[model samples]
Target: MRLPEHFLNNRKLESLVENQSSFTLDHAAMHIFETHQQAEQVLLQFDQPVLASMIEGKKVMHLRDYESFQFLPGESLVLPSGELMCIDFPEAEYENPTRCLAMAISEEKITKVLDWMNETMPKTGGLHWGLMDYNFHFVNDAAVFQILQRLVFLFTEDHPYKDYFVDNMLRELIIRILQTNELKIYGSDTFTLRENSRLAHVVRYIRTHLHESLDIATLSKEACMSASHFHRVFKNELGISPVEFINNERVKLAVSLLQNPEISIKEVYMCCGFESRSYFNRVFKHKQQITPGDYQRLLQRSMF
Candidate 1:
């Protein structure tokens, strides 16, 4: 997502490389960085966990365990405390600067939220609420994108009760981020399922039967629980409802199918168990910020 034009216009031309403007709240601090002119091997480190979101232009990120990769707009990276970053700017210029927002959050704040979550809404299969200790880079999902946009506004604007608003937002942001991370792990082909756990059995069932009509009653049977209880437990454990999880799985399968040039969009939706074209488009667009057809076209252009 793009930053407000007013914020961009008011930036001071202090440095040609990685210019910084800072804003602070009680539990976190946000720094807006703008870089002009090509730069290489620029080092950055944080004392607290930092969430970095790209706003404009591009960067080549060199981090542990990951090969150098392009950091583009609508992408984000999460780094743990004291993690070092080496960044490269191949396309920075006076007229075309690379802009990014880095938000550093306190460890205590994170710990408090994690403790509360584990106590009140414990995850299934003995999983605990926590953040990844290593660097995590991902495309901005719709929920994350919306939260980041609101956070930027809250941090940049002047308000007497700024910390109160931001603190609440930060709690949600943390929960959403953890939920996204868990979804990635659970949805991965390599993630092993513990056969004894109810959630594992239900997840396995859902994955295998995605092409069929899935209802809560059927899924609850897989978990050996009633439909109402299963729904509540699933949402509590995963931070998403059973229906949402099903739709997410369907959309993910649709994405994989769409990559094949031989697969028509209709075929993709049908294979993913979508009842109609319009419903598929709406669900896919909501998650990915683009219609299935548009996404496929963009994919084709990139490949060719």
Candidate 2:
């Protein structure tokens, strides 16, 4: 994946604080910012998947095509790449005005870490422990918060070995995230059955083939189940029917494609696996509650 040109230009730098008070990190990284200034819809674009955690103050984190989460001092929120997030701060201010950190993790690095842990940690059965759903909150322990504080200090301070320290600390931070076991939703079951596993396989397949025609019968066959049964089980497992899930995934791809001015809407429609422009528009508007042109305009407004 081609990262932004600025990212390539600042590869060697550990941290950059822009005039807008947002910080950027180049490594398995987190951008930390603290400000009392009221933000007018702060939107961030990540080249890699990112986890944004609010270490201080109450803030609202909203993600497109996912869920929204409210973070207190000790809570953290996770966001995937190509996801647009809106952060809103409380109107009444006390001690601070939205101090948060955005951590970016390379997909390749995460895969390698998961593979290593799968081989080394027999109990996990090759499952990636750091996998988090969009907009979910994980309460941080004291140790984790301390590590984050140290990282912030290292990032802000001009120490001689800042890069070395930051890299080692980031590795440790990933280990902490892997070891965390506080993931749960109220009144939700945590077990997986054979049927649910099949549904998960279907979801993974859809994600992998976002640019291809996703027929229900083909997907059902891929899951080794009848179409009716697959639809029922998939809806039960993922809280959405298979077809809805596919359309949602396509809309997500469409939003990403719309970010590029070079790609025409027609080209984006075909590239994102829409059969026709009208169908794409219909689905996009139905999901986003706005037409693709309006969505692009919103993004452009945010850019300025």
Candidate 3:
């Protein structure tokens, strides 16, 4: 998304690099940081938990205990309140400046959301819903990207009810982030060994039986849950329905299968347990924004 010309022109020339512009609401604040020259070991910290996303250019993040990694656009990192960040801008220039946005969220707002989640959502292994208390860096998914874009608009736009709009979006954004953290943990290969979480066992079962016909009843039995409760818990925990999760796993399998040049599209879909080619095409297109055939063709072309 492009910054408005007025916003760009109106920024105060406070510093050559890491110039900051802030917009505040009742429960949160948004900040835009632009760096116009090469910089090293730039220090940043937040008094409140912050969700930081790269808008343009690159940054090398230096965090304790982890190797420095490139922070690029379309990626985000969540830091707990007061966590220090050491960032480097190696490619900032007058013509191509590095830009990033940080949304600092109030503890009250976080508590409200966490209360609602704990009251409504049920987690396996007797875990309660809480924001992970460490650094979480990930590439933004579609839902996350959409919410961030809306947040940028809400933060910058002039409106009579801007606070109300931002509050609602903040709740949603927090939920999305929490769900993403859950997915990251439960969706990993290491999580399968965690026997206390029935959901993890269910995920393992789904992976092993991905090429077979799967039904809610069978999966519910695996989790020792009733069908209705299973569906509700799964969706509440993962923010996606069982059918959606199964299809997603199937699509992942189809992607791996398509890597083999010898596989036909029909065979790929069949082996991934898709019911029919047309249905597979629809689901794959919806998930990947590209048809399987097109993806395969592109892959083949890249190979050659």
Best by TM-score: 3
Q: How do all the candidates rank in terms of lDDT, highest first?
A: 3, 1, 2
Better of 1 and 2 by lDDT: 1
Q: Please give the clash total of every predicted structure, in order.
A: 0, 0, 0
Q: Each prediction's Cα lDDT score?
A: 0.87, 0.64, 0.89
Query: What is the Å distance of residue 107 in model 1 from its true position?
Result: 0.5
- Model 1 TM-score, 2 decimals: 0.86
**Model 3 clashing residue pairs (backbone):** none
Candidate RMSDs in order: 3.1, 16.6, 2.6
Better candidate number, 2 or 3, judged by TM-score = 3
lDDT of 2 by residue, 1-304 (tens): 1123443344343322111223434466656555464554566677787766665566666767656666677776666687776766654243334556777777876676656654554221123344545555577766678777777666666667787787677766665665453213211234342444555566667777878899989999988879887776554334346777788778988998999866788888988888998999999999888998888888888989
Off by over 4 Å in 2: 1-26, 65-67, 92-95, 124-130, 181-190, 193-304
lDDT of 3: 0.89
Which one wins on lDDT? Answer: 3
Local lDDT at 201 for model 1: 79
| lDDT of residue 208 for candidate 3 | 92
Summarize candidate 3's per-residue lDDT along 266-293 as a digit string, tens digits.
9998898889999999999998999999
Indicate the residue-level lDDT of 139 in model 1: 82
